[model samples]
Target: MAQTEQRAAPAAPAGHSVTAVAARMRELRASWPPADGVAVFNNVYLTVTEEVGRNIGRRRFPDRRGAATLDAVFAERYLAAVDAVAAGRRPPACWRPLFQYRHHPGVRPLQFALAGINAHIGHDLALAVTDACRLLDCEPAALEGDFHRVGDILERLEERIREELMPGPDLLEIVDPLTHLIGSWSLERAREAAWSAARILWGLRELPGLAEEFRDGMDASAGLVGRYLLTPLR
Candidate 1:
């Protein structure tokens, strides 16, 4: 994804408040048509975030504050990605493909949801982890437990997506492109990369230039996968 106009700010400053990110996402869903790719992904993400919020309220995680902070910061990154796109500032590499193909009628809702998830998890997640650390004044190691809990929720949500969105059994041929796409991309793999990236970012926190370079590379690589995921099969 080539950079176009520069954003007024990079995807929500490092510590931008996340208090309204979920609500903003909900608003986006309401504002767009149901078939809109961004709206489709927004709806799914909103549900996951809402669930996380509810669980946080219930004190489900061992580290309640960490969980809340992680969830909030995590959401902020996605919202920022959208903001970047809206400003025509060239959203992160992972997200550019989704925004570009958002209104393409040939893309399925499931594809939209998956591409968004891929971008968010593969790219935003590591950065979000760093954001949480900055806000909480803690180390990434301290947030590992919270990260795992959130990852668990994401995994379950992915399973639900498959159950609800996959085509009927009769149409589920092994050669289907969607099937191949799903099988090729692993959320677990993304989660692992996020952890490693978080640690790397933390280690390079003092070297802002180097850290930004790593982030850009990650974004571009993830975006490439997203583009592949969004390939128009029809």
Candidate 2:
């Protein structure tokens, strides 16, 4: 598949609103070929963001503003990475694997989808929670409800993603490496760890040096997991 250039929309004055974020995702989905790893991930994430937006509109969250704020901030991290790659700059470690292997023919679409999820949920979610707290002038505890609600949405979507993307038995053997690889990571577990990391990051806010170090470590760790998830199965 030929790679298409993906340009991110300008950041909103207050950061990207959910609507703007969704629009940018839609643009990427349209511009990139379906087989492109980033587009594969973009489609799944777009569905997740759209669903979250609907839930927020229906007042499903106790703190609607907080949920929206968290959702937007979380999305901005991914978008920032995309923007970086588009501009020929290096993205964060957590996002590098997907961009680097996006065109690899040996990797399956399912791996592409999960790799993106691993980077976003494992790395971006924690930082987003902290960012949202700072923007809302609240603590991580205040956003806990919103955090879980968003996570609940992601958990549900992950099930659907697996069902929709998993290869048939004819295409994948029982002992395939992809099977074991997929089984190794769990979105639910990732969410739990993300929540813990968010609280830790919030605590480290008072120590900039320690906080940056922790953030860098988290990014690199998630990127390593992403690389594992994208391991070619063919």
Candidate 3:
């Protein structure tokens, strides 16, 4: 997507509201250049948050509150990272690559988008699930339905992103390095891993030290994958 003329940053969201999150995404999209890696991811994520909001409004989820809470909490993780970067602080390890490479001209838009997805789904989503569980006073199982519903939306959107952002056949041959690089990551597998991590994190909730260590490991591992995903293929 082409970037629009720069505009003022939107107001920070007052709370965990999906509408507010979507607005913030729009603001970021308007403020950043189209070629920026973070902007690329933000555009994709904006579409997702909008779709999720619509689903919530249409009563797609059996538990509306749970779905909304989960969506907002999940989005907050990404937005907070954006805030941290703007404040000259380091974001979580999983998000470091995307922010670090946001302006690299060699990274394709699709690569940027996928790297962001990997960081969010691979690391942030797990933590978000546990965060939501704590806020809602429930176990991970209680939010399983909502989690899958959100994942389903993400899966469909990911397919669309690939279809839209993939380079043309003439530009991308069967043995193209870019093709192989992009193919190395899978959203399905990431989502599965995130779900497992969420369960484990939830189980270790009582053991704060162990949970923190596990969370740190998850963050670092996801960051590693994200760095690879953003590998310059041009």
Q: What lDDT does the true structure give each of the candidates?
A: 0.82, 0.88, 0.88
Candidate 2 structure lDDT: 0.88
RMSD of each predicted structure: 8.4, 6.5, 5.8
Q: For candidate 1, lDDT tens digit of each residue in 16-91?
A: 4334667788789878999888888889999888777666655567776777778878887888888888887977
Candidate 2 per-residue lDDT, tens place, 46-123, comes to 999988887777667788788888899999899999999999999999999999999999899999999999999889
Native-to-model Cα distance after best TM-score fit, residue 194 in candidate 3, in Å: 0.5
The sequence of per-residue lDDT tens digits that candidate 3 reaches over residues 47-130 is 999888877776677887778888888999999999999999999999999999999888889999999999999999999898
Q: Where is model 2 poorest over a 10-residue stretch in terms of lDDT?
A: 1-10
TM-score of 2: 0.92
Model 3 misplacement above 4 A: 1-14
- Model 2 ranges with Cα > 4 A deviation: 1-13, 171-173
